[model samples]
Target chain A: MTNTILVLESVVLVLLTVLVAGLLRSHAEILRRLHALGAGLDPDAPTSELASMPVELRSRVSGSFATAADLDGAGLRDDALHVAVVGTRHRTLLAFLSSGCLTCQTFWTAFGEPARLDLPDDIRVVVVTKDASEESVSALRKLAPPNVSVVMSSTAWSDYSVPGSPYFALVDGGAGRVTGEGTGAHWDQVKNLLRQAADDASDDSREVRIDRELREHGIAPGDPSLYRTAEQIAQESRA
Target chain B: MTTTLAAHGLAIGLPTGWEGRIQRRAVSVAAEQTHAVVHLANFALPEERDDFGGGVTPLMRSADVFVVLFEYGPDAVGKPLFATQGIPRVTADMFGSKRLQRPLPGQLGCQRFFTAHGRPFCLYVVAGSRAYLPRILAEVNGVLTDLDVAP
Candidate 1:
């Protein structure tokens, strides 16, 4: 009977050892999973697993234009060339030109053909030229399109930060922000800038709409998990 | 969500459900000192209060993405685009020792350098998972494209 009892004790010890080993292995597996998940969230974690991934070059400036500063001055189109840029419903394009500058003549020549300007209806193009003699004004008047507004202001060059003649700036009058600004050396370049600004404005509104959707779902802007997906766990595991 | 780093003359569009903060640090290279602005965004995790004896260890301050803008002097003209030599292999040095190099495959997110109005700038983006990388990159590209650098 003692032998049988000893055998039974040995069997129990073997069984206990196996169970403990199994438990340890299971615990290790759990720890490994936790580690993987933690690493996924770590920005410093090495991404060697992704070394073979393809690199894509995407345009950063597509449909975007440089931000413009607020134009500081007063008054709308009257006898004076200065127009009140601060409060207006339509977007304003301040074309800074001078009657004396040769480059301004080229810009004015381009401006003569309104159809060629290809500006959207919403953009109210205003010619801001330096005060000139009657002769210069008459020359400029012949070049100015009938639909475009023409004004004369000596302060515009300094106020608009136009380093020289043949410069242009697009102002979103509602926001009082410069949407675009550059030298009007090429009419195509000016047109591209305007298109880019309009595209950027639309893109901004789209982003706002997306932000609203996230807010409705109780997610705020800057939430890192905003783009998290159910498949992310699988992707992390593969990595 | 979108916020502007007005001091750096930058505007960034943050992913929805994320939170962001800006920290500015002064850095110097070869006696030329400049400011580096870091826009850090992270997951909006709920606060976990420690109730037991285990000390309250702060959650790791790891972020999903970091947008770093190196501010140069107005007179600083960026090196030509063709001068791609010696682009720092490690990003830790750019932000100082505090940051880490969490590069994507081929260092895609951390590789490129940019210039605006003659000011040199670099961007680094990190994603929690490969699945989110493409979208994050696209968004980052948008921000960089529309970036307004003060001249």
Candidate 2:
């Protein structure tokens, strides 16, 4: 071949090689992002599931009424009830709670019944609090998911199991095992796990009527007799 | 007696002569780059600290000092843009611990609190960052040095 032609061919080859490498690197980055999205759904799952499984609070309750009754019967008042509520979830919703927790206050504005309308019908959400009082629960209830259960467990502060506020767990109620648990920077990921748990339980046949169970345990369902009503709760506590 | 310290960053006014040394510092790895530290010397008498949970030295006690660090700036209102660091230590050891005490992550950031003199103060301290550390400390030290106390 002519010298000029040889030089031109070499130049073309180098350009093609660069283009190929660039494309591969870009492809890898895209795959990495896609994998991250996929991992949000399930560590081993594909990307398509992430969109289909946006973290949501399913409206339906988890845990057996029998179990809730058992907890109530055990005199799990105030904080203990909160623990039971957290324990009942298919996934643990770390209660970013404290009488003065700033994160919980931020989330109080972000999460709530009206805001969580976008969530599915079966996801169970709960609030964990260090200070479990009728007043605190009333204030928090205004900012929680509808039909989302709440528990104020001071024991959670010392559970030694939970490292900080806003910690979460994937609880298998049927198995009573914490299938997945984490703290700090994984709320969205844990929310995804909660949705996943609900999806997983879509096929499991177990139902617990919380109110009836509480009644059986001699704990009234609509509202505890300690306070006349939600409005009076704050005042009563102050008194 | 109510003594009001002028607004520097997140603090509106600190109670003067309340037996506390307020030092401000900028945090380097926090959402809010600037922060402050308020070390309340002679925080509480031994009895008061015991009345409340002991994990934190209650500001109401005599021996306890409330050391708090937060962000300060004009753009501080109604924004998730600051961090807070608090340490309940002894008045003698306010500056002993180099590591900032951490509260629950999301639970912290911004706050409004009252001092013993009933002066209102605001705070926003971000974690792991030190953007305005020097300025915060200088201003707080100046205030403490100039404080007029009632014996």
Top-TM-score candidate index: 1
Please, what is the TM-score per model?
A: 0.38, 0.27
Q: At residue A76, what lDDT does model 2 achieve?
A: 14
Best by the lDDT measure: 1
Against the reference, the lDDT scores of all candidates come to: 0.51, 0.38
Per-residue CA lDDT of model 1 for A119-163, tens digit only, reads: 886676777766663227666657676555566656566666666
**Candidate 2 residue-wise lDDT, B32-98, digit = tens:** 5443334332222111121112333322222222334332443443344322222111221222223
How does residue A61 of candidate 1 score in lDDT? 52
TM-score for candidate 2: 0.27
Per-residue accuracy of model 1 over B19-135 as CA lDDT, tens digit each:
322324333467765544434333321111111101111222233444444444444444564233222223322332222243233222343455555556555544444444455
Q: Where does candidate 2 chain A have its weakest 10-residue lDDT segment?
A: A67-76
TM-score of chain A of 2: 0.38
In terms of docking quality, model 1 is: incorrect
